[model samples]
Target: MTQTQNTTHGGPDALGVPAWDFSSNANACGPCPTALAAVQQADASLYPDPTYAALREAIAAFHAVDAGRIVLAGSASEFIGRVSAWTAREGGRRAWWPAQAYGDYAQAAQAWRLERTDDPAQADLAWLCEPASPLGGAEQQAHQVVGSALQVVLDRAYEPLRLRGVCSLDPVAQNHVWQLWTPNKALGLTGVRGAYAIAPEHALTEARALEQLAPSWPLGAHAVAMLDAWLSSAAQDWLTHSLPTLREWKRELCAMLEDLGWTVTPSDANFFCATPPHRLNAMALRSHGVKLRDATSLGLPGQFRLSAQAPEAQVALRRALIAQKERVA
Candidate 1:
């Protein structure tokens, strides 16, 4: 009896071409039985109340800020969407967009008819990213934040720098800025849709009133369970301890790609950007079963944003990309 194996990962890997999808900002969370059970047990309960209460404490404590500063939401995207609406209602001023930032920032500004301006002091809002999501390098990063003119809406998706660092919550910008954080991106909870906003405590005054006029809110009992489990010292230790292995894997990714002749932007964050040799564009990379964000969208000099996935996955990607190099030559 040829028993069929239950394959859990549903991707092009099933095909001969290895799949390297580095489009997301999330760790490949371990689906431990205990954590999975927390989600399963929530099958018959309402989550918003319990989840929010627990997460409120957990997240705020993590950031070392007051819980009131947080606006737990479906995702960082939601926080941005609502905040843009608030900016509009308060009279959308000229929008400050990074020379290169998350695509949604442009969409958010347009939805509210915000004018674009690179000058920060004269700007009404600044929508930006940190570790500069699409592209990353020490010098490029320093240039991005070297001397800001106005309020900073730091997209600290990579802030904790892998669990051990002091979960820096944009301290410099905390005085008069709005930042986005998503546990989904940070804690391998991508599938959970857990995100929170860290604004100055006073921004809460303006935000709380606005939140009332906002739509209904709820935290899935399941999501809460995951958050609860994640808050425990045990879970924290697990994540905090995994940094070395994670860092090693990331370094391996950069070294391997470099050895294969790819120009990877230096990044300590979970991902990095790469400029393929002139002969190859993003589609060519995708053809090898890796779906990278096209750098062309950022109007940058590259055409790919690669990530470091599981070690096995990285090995597969390295081989595929190397094969592509040979094919082009």
Candidate 2:
């Protein structure tokens, strides 16, 4: 797909929202009550601290890192753009990312005129999203690219929602790369649009550069509130409690799709990609208020990425798929 078309994200748009959305990978058991309450109670009347000192401190404490190493972002997309810009500013000529991964990485690279490289070592910058989107599988190349001269940024957006498997990188290895986290996904509050990157330990220079590139007041009050709640023990406990429910739902959904002859790919996160035995008319399903992310944009043609959702939503999806099949028949 062309860059313009490939960059399309799965969320409410001109077609309106889906009744059973399995497009975006937000936690099925969320918006967590604690985080939701915090967002609702956010004082939007006043601007957040420009320095984001308190917010940074809170996030830093949660990760047990120095506040100075925390680089704030308006959102994951914003950070992608800012980092791409930083790469460009530093005379980076090329960028590398997974062949099938988030489209924004490519979009940002395109905007900055950075040539795409398939080999990590050949690129000035590289992007890695663990339990990556579309397939939701562990990144096979993660360990290989480490210790290279490549400026690697690990997108840990799905880490909180990971249902199984251990991360490929140990603490020492993780400390060598930029670790980006978007709490909104874990909190099931994507609308809040706040993210932060824990700069590699001892990489204060690069961290300072990223901070300088970001816009002032990168996070608004609501985003700050959601993120603040994200670091709380109550919120963590809520997320912990939701995982078992998600695991069970995932198992049921996978079984249902497999029984229907869909090729469900194994995944460690809350989402997975599958290709049906027959071609599926996605728009037809969307008409019935059921939506699945067309993975063609994420470089997986003839497949769709589905997020684990409540059983009722799964039932709605199954009904819609059957209806579509009937219509085609």
Candidate 3:
């Protein structure tokens, strides 16, 4: 079966794109004006620099890291596969990740034939996602694995959108694990697929190995523009300003869900998991152009994840839920 068939995700288009989508955890206040303008101005007619020298430099400067430490990928999913393959090539035989996480981690490990292990110390490679997917909470045992000899990659996709709490790792701890970043989600431009990883400090050999595995020109002009724009003062400012709004929206959304008899879990990011008092006909809701991510694939059965969206979207969701209930009645 194809990958789509094998794995389910929040932002599926098979049911037609939802009008009030609460499935994807993208910034509700974005695409940031500056970032969107940059993407629009991208000169798609010409091929981006084959080596992505300038792109790498822009990303490196944003993260305050050496240019050599920046490894580009088409997207987070692409990086997961490439990195898993790299681990396999380097004689990695076992992988460990949170019981709840982005599905690509497991899919990549399985594709590379790495045995799955629950214990982080026993695994050749470990994956950690702070403000993790579905749950939007801190990674468990994150502090214990820091500075370990075992290869670890910390997915920081949600770090930019974090509304509360700090990352578990300090600067010294952060230097030991690969920091994977995808700016599109935070930019509210998830369609613009591009991502990068900051290699562990002093790991020039591992950095070169990842680069060699990457296909030529992994990032196209638009992606390059998005990543570059992501570093702009205006873009950063916009993101910083949007957090308060998202925090308010998240508060109201959670309260509304709780009123509807759903148990809302606390989260650090702009999304949270909830279990309704009654089983929901998610497909029925989707037919009405309202979509919520089923958390089952993320190891939380009978619960759904909803991204913090505009007030109007929340109203639409409440109406849709009530309508679905009426239809079932």
Candidate 2 TM-score, true structure as reference:
0.96
Model 1 per-residue lDDT tens digits across residues 1-329: 11011111212233333355665556644443445667677764443663366678777887788777777666667767677777777776777766766767788888888778766666666765656656553224333432453445666677644422332334553555666775445566556765667776567786574455445654566666776666666666666665666677778878887777778776657677776655554455555566555555665644566656777778667676777767777
Candidate 1 residue-wise lDDT at 74: 62
Which should have the higher TM-score, number 1 or number 2? 2
lDDT of 3 by residue, 198-308 (tens): 999998789989999999989999999999999899999999999999999999999998998899999999999999989887877777778888888889988988999
List the candidate 3 regions with Cα displacement exceeding 4 Å.
Answer: 1-7, 147-149
Clash count of each predicted structure: 2, 0, 0
lDDT against the true structure, per candidate, is 0.61, 0.89, 0.89
**Candidate 2 residue-wise lDDT, 222-292, digit = tens:** 99999899999999999999999999999999999998889999999999999998988777777788888
Residues forming the 10-long window of minimal summed lDDT in candidate 1: 1-10
Better of 1 and 3 by lDDT: 3
* Model 1 accuracy (lDDT, Cα): 0.61
